[model samples]
Target: MKFNKKIFNLSAWITLLIAYVLPYQSQSSDGHSTYLGYPLSFLTINNTPIYKTLFMTESIDIFTLTIDILIVYFVMHFANVYLSKVKLNKGMNKTKDFK
Candidate 1:
């Protein structure tokens, strides 16, 4: 299999979609939401570095939320790229095995 730039691009786009589509919760009982690839929890809001303020405060900071989302998007994109490379490498190895 050949390395496809489109696949990497598609994965990035998907990551961005997921990051933005996931809702941000203001409290621990705001229902299900996701930021980046990890599920967001009101119970564990204190555990999040970016969400530490949510623990003490009821309001969400738009700036921090946006920055965190962007960070997560990049992390997911790079992870997708690396995984795709590994998959392509495995496919190439299998073809060689057949020969």
Candidate 2:
């Protein structure tokens, strides 16, 4: 199979969008919080001991975001490759039947 740049780019963007919309969220009663997203977090709510009952804070975790992006990208790539192979096989089978 040949590598397609368009497919690669499309998968990258799709994975990013998915990561952006769906992030890993966590909340703890101990005043610790986490909201990790791909590339950047849209919103984060952190609770400190003092502000735990009052309000929350916001921040980004680059390490987790990078890992999340990588994971989603690989999964998307695998699905894309698998689907393309299935499609190619179907086409080949159709041609064989015609012959």
Provide backbone clash counts, one per model: 1, 0
lDDT of 1 by residue, 25-97 (tens): 4333453333332233212223345645654533344555455555555666677779989999999999999
Give the backbone clash total of model 1. 1
Candidate 1 clash pair list: 28-42
Q: Estimate each model's TM-score.
A: 0.43, 0.59
Q: Pick the candidate with the highest lDDT.
A: 2
Compared with the true structure, the alpha-carbon lDDT of candidate 2 equals 0.62
Question: After superposition, which runs of candidate 2 have C-alpha atoms over 4 Å from their true positions?
Answer: 1-25, 32-44, 47-56
TM-score, model 1 to reference: 0.43
